[model samples]
Target: MDFRGRTVIELGAGTGIVGILAALLGGDVTITDLPMALDQIRENVRRNAAAVAAAAGRARVRALAWGRELSSFPRGYDVVLGADVVYEPRCFPALLATLRHLCGPRSVAFLSCGMRRELGAGRFFDTLLPPHFHVELLRRHDDTDVSLYRLTQQHDDTNVSL
Candidate 1:
């Protein structure tokens, strides 16, 4: 996609690989993980900073607690990225809420996760979405499912193109 000048945030970045990919692809990206994952994020960021710098793309790692405060995040990002973030019954609501708060009116979120028996496909989306998103299942990677969503709050309509 055309992410050359877009500010992007990557959520649940296990090793910051997904965020790395976005940065490498020319998107301005910020990599976020829990406080415990800071080491991994730093290592990956350090290893790739030279390459990313040459590409004119920037990447940074910050501590993002999903079930907690979202006010720590800076505002105005064009895209929000997440990978393998579904499963916990208790954390699902907070996760989706964080997504909504981080992404502004005209933002697109790309979430990739392998839906398990626990994360029911029927009740896929949380009920808290702002009713202004277009969700699309991009493709299934082996047993993992990668989905993309276009979140636009300018209007109040949820249209899914199945």
Candidate 2:
């Protein structure tokens, strides 16, 4: 997709790989994770600063805990990225809430998940589909046991396409 001049954020950005790559592709990126993960994200951003500069893209690090106070994060992002974010059963509701808060009807979110039975991945999708969002499968990497999904907000008046 076109990243030029687009605003993007990555949720649960462990090492900030996705955000740094997005920055290198000319997106204005915010690489976010829990408060404890900020230092690592910052270091990754620092390591990729040259590429980000060369691409004329900007990247910043932020701390965002899902389902908590969300006033600090800006809304209406064109795209949101999440990699391996749906592992915890207890976090499903929080992550869903965060996704709804950040995405609009036209906004797109890419979520990558490892479908482990012990992680309660099915339960996450069951809660996500009805009242808040519509999801479409983007791709599945069998070797890595990962599935990527594209999500759009579910509007009262319209059906959202992925």
List the candidate 2 regions with Cα displacement exceeding 4 Å.
158-162
- For each candidate, what TM-score against the reference? 0.83, 0.92
Clashing pairs in 2: none
| Per-residue accuracy of model 2 over 1-162 as CA lDDT, tens digit each | 778898999999999999999999999998899999999889989988998999999999988999888777877799999999989888888988898888876789998889786887866766555577787887888897788888888777645355
lDDT for 125 in candidate 2 is 68
Best by lDDT: 2
Q: Could you tell me how far off, in angstroms, the CA of residue 120 lies in candidate 1 after the best superposition?
A: 3.0
Over 39-125, each residue of candidate 1 has an lDDT whose tens digit, in order, gives 988899899998888877889888888857788786658998888776576786777678767877678787766666566532555
Model 1 accuracy (lDDT, Cα)? 0.75
Q: Measure candidate 2: CA RMSD.
A: 3.1
